[model samples]
Target: SKTVSTILVTGGSSGIGKCIAIECYRQGAFITLVARNEEKLLQAKKEVEKCAINDKQVVLCISVDVSSDYSQVESVIKQAQEKLGPVDMLVNCAGTSMSGKFEEVEVDRFKKLMEVNYLGSVYPTRAVITTMKERRMGRIMFVSSQAGQIGLFGYTAYSPSKFALRGLAESLQMEIKPYNIYVTVAYPPDTDTPGLAEENKTKPLETRLISETSGVCQPEQVAKIVVRDAIVTMGLFRTIALFYLGSFDSIVRRCMIQREQSKAADKRE
Candidate 1:
């Protein structure tokens, strides 16, 4: 029932972001996909236009590195607003995995995850929230992971960033409630995406073993449910997928993470 005439999806060239962009077009939302890869963005734009229900709902692609600075993200948001009108929806989906023990992983790897995963979500939300607040309507969704809800082994650089996202969304939900803006944070199961496939190969054997123990869902499937929940129910159904993730405490604590190094050890364990 909710209508998003103009939407922005970060990391829209691949994985869940690309699928979300396509689904938004199917639902009649004009989309601007932001990512660093111009070639992929162009290809994704074509695919979205092909599935678009309303040709009038324009699909635009802008190349921007979400992991960089806030200023870059803000500029992209400003451009999207001027070109496509105010952003009715914002989806934060750009992220990467760094596999290794926390001590073995480089500091830069952790920093990269924080910038792209946590700050990637933060910068865009900051850029658009003012307008959404002024207009008194908007939808903000974060494509967090099941690992974020629980924890995954060898997710040294990845899990903290996603966990940070949950904290960010929880705080923002209360702050934005008065403005009639909705914030939905999703924790999807391991998704079958190119990125995940690559990680499965390069990551240590332990990482692959742990991933098999849990189920993996298709990106398109997760995207469909995410879009349906974000648009139709707003923030009401945010924790549904994440709730099941909480059941794996042992996996979160013993196999996946170092017991001595855990941050939210008591809460998750």
Candidate 2:
């Protein structure tokens, strides 16, 4: 197994982020939780600490709005590094979603979703990437949704932001592959999270129906799959599928490749 000693998780105060933090802590990593809510960050820190292997294991929390300012995100990451040493892994779990028809959702809401979902991941990755490059070793994971791979009804504002993350992950993988850093994107289905609960409140009927086709998953389960994929050294465009819909893209791609191969063989014959 890969040894990841220090981990920084954005949105670590709740949902998938909190679960990832606790799971990494259980695996003996020094955990740093960053989010906007001070109360929740403190609570997450306490929960993660309980999973620490020994008293020396550290669990720290920093309250900051990841989408508000890039410099602030960079500074907080630096502080965490000073306390826990260089981060071996950075999980971009800080994101939000809005569900409604394209026209019904305000233009500002689309922008807000982009800022929180896309730039939120970008800022922190920008902060630590250089150090990881200097060391020529690290792991990065982006928590994109199943909707990212396949567009879904009511996710017009949300899906595009997630799709942007896949683009970022693919491009970053190309640039960072030579540095020995691993990048993985995870597509989890509708998960039972506080964020999801809030999203459901505004979710359109059609959107809810589309999402219900794929059963929900627990945050803990998704976290395990994400962490496991992050540790493995892999090529660019690697995706972790946590549910049926999450694997749809990969399945379609595989079929296309198989068809092409068959055609090539027939031509040779």
Candidate 3:
């Protein structure tokens, strides 16, 4: 059984974040569910509470945008610690995605995605890290996406935001290793989540095609894998993950060929 006692998860109101909270609760850990929606946070707290193995475990909910203001994030984290004890693990799971061809996507969305996906994670991690280092024990998980590891045809805006997490995870691990705080970056397969549903409305055909190569995964499955990995150690890309990347490359190449042939036919007309 996992030994960590308290965990704080940004974006814990739904999807993979909620599922991760549930899994940890089942293992008898106190949980802090953070999100921007008070309603959703309450709903998630109820769900996570149902999974507790011991009556002593507590579930706390806080509504705040992790990406908005650093001071606000820091304040909320301090409150959480005062109530539940220092964070044993921090999960940076709050992120947003907008998918379209580079030209078709509004320039402003690029900044929004970066603010939500990159800086959103940075704020929470920064708030908790000082305490983690002082305690000499902690685990941090960055919930990156498969797109984080591989650039696809229509993910010009989204991929880069996700990719930034890898840099954060790797570099943070190097500095924190001596303190016994492990940092893990997870490239979870495209999962069935509310965030993904919103992105699909604007997702481009080429990006959808490449994403389909790996098929969509369930958020619960992703949470299980990621939570397990986060506890074990910092790791590199697994062999199976590399194989999926190879498959995605073929899809991108096929889309490129189709676009060229379509252009040739139009010119002939």
Candidate 4:
């Protein structure tokens, strides 16, 4: 069966989410935007409408907290599928952060970060996986971070959540390969988004230093490249040029060493 014209994006109300939603709309893909804030979702819908070349449909904003649970995510997905038809693609962008030394960060904050960043993708993937599997076709992309690719100081809470997502994508890719469900994990350089700017102000100096050193790519630039990659990739880590994979491996090793040293010092103190 030819896929439907719609794509679903979580966290689509703002930042890179909003940018990608707009880009997809401009490319004539009908979009279903999922986010927690109704007002922000409406604003995103307006932006998508402005960019849309086809008046076929502007965009459908489904206010949803994708992290809550399977039932909640499934309910939203059902509504979107009913209204927009089968979702041809899903971009899991809903995420949150809890930055502080691990000891300074509260347990609740850590759990909240994990719920929103990791389980946010899990719940929605659970909702859509069966259908995509049955159809044997779909595209799923994750807006992971350089933190996931290479941990910086004080991402104690945030890094683990994104790292879990990378692992999830790796596992799911293998499982879905035979079904032709492509999965791409994107590692965007720090992007100048409203959320990112807010994070910059509060981030620990060490974390800020790393971000300052690594050029902050614009949201539009990351969005366009990610969309293009999503369209072109086959499945899993395969289509990602091997050099990046090798580079990612090296970074992960270095990060692990740094984390070990930090943990040891904390234990001694």
Candidate 5:
């Protein structure tokens, strides 16, 4: 019977972020959607406005790269707060993914992921944490990926950035718990989103094969269950991961053999 009064979501222009906004909007929360693209933000605002349950509900859109400048992120967040009232919930969903063999991935790509995935979450959290502490209550959510849990083939550049979110969540929880603020870190599986489709285009054969073994989930499906993933499943989850690691190893071996054979054939010509 309780409802969050104001919800601010970065990367809410698309993917799981937008869906989360819609779900919360249905509960009558005032919504603010932040992303880098102005067109997409407006489009997302229209889609989210459809789920409004009360005439009082409002959807605001702000376009700014969450990872670019801390001051800029803080400024936009302040503007959003001024318009929508203090943010009751801050969702850090703005992140990017790139995949390739460790040695093949451009060195710059690793730094880019850290900026988008780690600092993107940090800037917004930094901007709002102070106010949340002053108010003595709020919820902060980080949307990480399954890759965050176990490093996999071709995720050499992407996994660590996602993994960093868990560390941030764990440390932030301890500091904020005393103020009655809670942090939630969601490790969602391969989701069917534009981001995933783009990532697939560049994924290594090994990564793609491993991904097929664990299909994909729709955004709405993910948005529904991640809220409950707070349950302690680490013990069993790690055991299962080891089994998958064995399968992943075989997949990588198979791809290596195929690539070597193709290279040898080219030499004969």
Candidate 6:
């Protein structure tokens, strides 16, 4: 079994990130939760601690905007290492989403989504990669969405940011492989989370109708899959490729069904 003694999770205050933290804690890894919300970070720390196998297992929280400053993120990561020891696993779960047609969406919204969803993952990975390489042992997982795999209605601003993660994961995996570092990218379907609720407010009606066809998945379920995949000894490239294929298959199947339904309606007319 891969040794995952110390774990750091960004966006750990809620949603899939929080669930991943809890799952990792359950596996006996010391957890560090990072998010922009101090209150939520503290709350998440309390929840993660409950899953700790022993009192000695430290559950820490850092309140920092992952998209804001790399220096601040690096500082917090250093502090976390000092208290909890080296991070054996880093999960890049910090991200944001928005929904609108490209023309209607504000340009700033596109930049903001990219900053949080793409660079948010990049900054933390940059912070940890050097140490992980020097130690020649580590695992990194990026929490990408099914939206990342394929463009979707009203997600023009959100999809590209996530798509960028896939490119990062692939290139980073190859570069880090010789150093014994592993990278895994997760493509979870629309998950039931507070973030999803917020996105729903801005989601276009067409987007809502299309997304609903695939239904919603639980954060816990996605977290479980992510953790499991992260620890697997399978080649990083193979793992990531399979994840994309599976998500792509789901998308294609859903679209075909929608098309068939449209044709049936046309026939009736």
| Best by the lDDT measure | 6
With a 3 Å backbone cut-off (N, CA, C), the pairs that clash in candidate 1 are: 153-256
Task: For model 6, state the Cα shift of residue 62 in Å.
Answer: 0.6
- TM-score on alpha carbons, each prediction: 0.84, 0.86, 0.86, 0.86, 0.83, 0.86
Please tell me which model should have the higher lDDT, number 3 or number 5.
3
Q: Write the per-residue lDDT of candidate 6 for residues 39-143, one digit (tens) a residue.
A: 898888888888877767888889899889999999999999888888899999999888888899998998999999999999999999989988989999988
Q: Residue 4 deviation, candidate 2, in Å? A: 5.4
Off by over 4 Å in 2: 1-4, 233-269
Worst 10 residues of 4 by lDDT: 233-242
Candidate 4 residue-wise lDDT at 78 = 91
Report clash pairs, candidate 5: none
TM-score of 4: 0.86
In the range 35-68, model 5's lDDT, one tens digit per residue, is: 9999999999999998888777899999999998
TM-score of 3: 0.86
Clashes of 4: 0
- After superposition, the stretches of candidate 3 with alpha carbons farther than 4 Å from their true spots are 1-4, 235-269
Tens-digit lDDT track for model 2 on 16-103?
Answer: 9999998888888888899988988888888888887877788888889888898999999999998889988999999988899989
Model 2: per-residue Cα lDDT at residue 133: 85
Ranked by TM-score, the better of candidates 1 and 3 is 3
Cα lDDT, all candidates: 0.83, 0.87, 0.87, 0.83, 0.85, 0.88
Cα lDDT for residue 62, candidate 4: 87
C-alpha positional error of residue 267 in candidate 2 after TM-score superposition, expressed in Å: 55
lDDT of 3 by residue, 184-218 (tens): 88898779999889889978888888889899999
